[model samples]
Target: MAPQSNKQWTVNGTSGFDALKFNENAPIPKLGDKDVLVRFHGASLNYRDLIIPKGQYPFPQRDGVVPASDGSGTVEEVGGQVTRFKKGDEVVTLFNQGHLGGSLNPTINETGVGGVIDGTLRQYGKFDEQGLVKKPKNLNFLEASTLSCAGLTAWNGLYGLESRALKQGDWVLTQGTGGVSIFALQFAKSAGATVIATTSSAAKAETLKKLGADHVINYKEDTNWGETARKLTPDQLGVHHVLEVGGPTTMAQSLKAIKIDGVISIIGFLGGVKGDQPTFLDCLTNICTVRGVLVGSRLMFEDMNRAVEANNIKPVVDEKVFSLEEVREAYEYMWAQKHFGKLCIRID
Candidate 1:
């Protein structure tokens, strides 16, 4: 492929809430040592994308910083010393730009791809080759786009802790049918752990079952849904793990549902930020552990792709592909939460 100019969305400073406008003046970024220039095929929207436009998360110093954390594309160019990826390689950019391996560090945590740095919602994106992972062969660009952030969050939340042990025949609980929870369901089932999933809609219960949920709970019908969760686990030991995406409001219920010495992975704040905090008595009674999860590293991304390839699992994507010009509509659709899976944008 020939070298080409870049096209991107620009958020005008005055109207922070306004839609991003196309800007031709944006310069195509130059590839540095160990860098790869990717011509993005598709990108996925996330809650973070909504936060950035409202200035909840400020953009980095780079001009015209596009706002999407996850995407997949074909490598268009690579700089000298780039070994892991090459031109024409299909890859996904890790959300954390340079955090490749080892334990998380403050330095590595400072920068991310889509927030505080230029993101993937563009016709082209550039990053260090270390930040890219080969897209799983089973996934198309749109499906792979959801993996970098959401998929990795689920993986890291379930497996990241050094102490928590998730074994075959164990039971895990996931709240809602959001991206992370859905990924957790698939991963837990693949690992031989039975999954109990929760959904607000009874209609979505069948879909959750189809995704391999061992038991599905309509949280709306059962106000005491935690008890329902306990009944689903083997020997009534309660679930071995809980993907705690519901934050404070549901934390107590999650604690109630987990078995003694169970692990709770805290990944989101969907269920309001303020509530009656859990007491030490509750912790002592349940012997539960809660771990905070940030989106994972590039190394985790590679491992996830390996698992995806090995299992031949395909991500569920309820996509509404929009041209670059219809970016605002795409954002609106995601905000409405009407879609069953990820919403994608076509960069071409």
Candidate 2:
């Protein structure tokens, strides 16, 4: 018998979480000639998901968009011309479908899932073969799902093409407990680099330490946490890398937090956009390279998977698993910023 309509969650408007809508019988995505279709098993949320719905995303947005970029699933079908994947193969979606390699361009923003294009929050997603990568061998669907955005963004920032890449005993300062920060911490630890993390309270600080942070800074208590982080490094010079997810509001501090020749990977804007900009003299004098990271490429994702499998690294997922029907609740939990790692939604 033909399958009943597929289940999915979608953004119906741009007001807020209230705009997210559920449908019991959304049509299953049809595969294109080079497309691969998958039955989604899990999806993970990033900080971007929280803002994308409010029409405040860094990129353009399309109405009635399916609202997630990170997902893992088994191949349900493949187009006749598809060759890379077969039915039943485990796979994860890429953050930017058109971004197979090289430099990201307008098409990346235009074709991005959950942004200008449809996303993977539904029961099924049809993707170009180039838009998918085999899941990490060591991870389950949920953990592997987190790779597309958070994992790749972290990998992109740390070991990506432009990165000097952390070495053993190098100091890395990750801000907050968001998905990107947590992933960066795990990857840095795996590489034998020292990690200094900043959080709001002692409890979360403990959590960061437990996750292998060498030092923890409570930014709320220490308004000058950046300088403190710099001092914690071996030579008291500054950290080798700063995962600057705080954007303009905290970039001035990130500039203050790096050693000469250090790199600051600008990942997000949790403190809101449009604040004081990083001073040119400070960056130039420090010789700091500031790069904007947007997830990663298919090749980079595949390479990171090799590392994830080799290290047996598992993504730290929030304990509260939201069902497909609880899209709003999951987003609300993320908005509260309490999730330790990634916020995952289970599809049944």
Candidate 3:
């Protein structure tokens, strides 16, 4: 392959709420020691991508920073000291280059892509070799792009160092069919766990069932579906784990649906971040552990890839794919909350 020119979107400012501007004449990054230059082919979108440009929480906007967090590509060049990967290796991005594992640190935020630094939505990116992971053999580039963020979030929440800790025959409550929730459902079922899912419509419920959910609850039809889900369980003691995607509103209900000493992995904020929720006393009374999750480390990404390769688990990608020119439109689509699973942008 020949040397490629870079085309990218950058945040010029934040006042208009439309902060992103594309620059086709952007300079290609030079490779440094221990660096690998990758020609990225695809990028996957997340809910965070929609909120980042509006001067919101999670991470503030930086002028001239690239916007998307997840990317996948083939290694094009390597510096003299690079050894982990050579040319032609298909690889995926890791959101945080530091904070390898075991404990949280400031480095995660400082070095985070699409947050505090330039991200991976560009046509080309030169990353340190240490920050990339080998793509799962069973997945194509578009499927592998999603693992950097949403996939790892589910994996880290379920199997991390301080994971809520699930096992075979355990019961899990998954909130929706978004990227993280869908991945959690697949992983739980793969581990021989019973999965109960909540969705807004009968059609999505049916789809969830086809994906192996044992029971699907329509939260729209039944406002008290949390209690209903608990009653459907074996002992009516509630699910052993709750993958809490809706923040406080669903969390209040998640509290009602949890077993004693159960765990809730709080991974998203779709339902509102602050509002009525389980009281501290309620958590104490039930011995329920609430664990907040960030996307996992390189180590967790590698472990999840091994499982994906061994089990042949395919990520659920939305049918629609946008090109690099439609980056803003892609974010708008994700913001509409209509996509069943992950969405991708083709950079080739």
TM-score against native, each model:
0.93, 0.96, 0.96
- The residue-level lDDT of candidate 3 at 131 comes to 83
lDDT of 3 by residue, 1-348 (tens): 566578898766654337778888788889898998888998998888776776655654466778878999999889999999999999998888775666668756677777766788898787888888999989988998988889999887778744456689999999988999999998888989999999999999999999999999999988898899899889899988888889888887898898988888899898876777777787887778888887888888898999899888999999999999888888778888768899999988
Question: If the candidates were sorted by their lDDT against the true structure, best first, what order would they fall in?
Answer: 2, 3, 1
Evaluated at residue 251, the lDDT of candidate 1 is 86
lDDT of 3: 0.85
lDDT of 1 at 55: 61
lDDT (tens digit, per residue) of candidate 1 on 104-189: 77777767776656788788888888788899999989889889888999999777875776778889999998888989998898
Q: Higher-lDDT candidate among 1 and 3? A: 3
> What's the ranking of the predictions by TM-score, best on top?
2, 3, 1
Q: How high a TM-score does candidate 3 get?
A: 0.96
What Cα-based lDDT does every candidate model obtain?
0.81, 0.87, 0.85
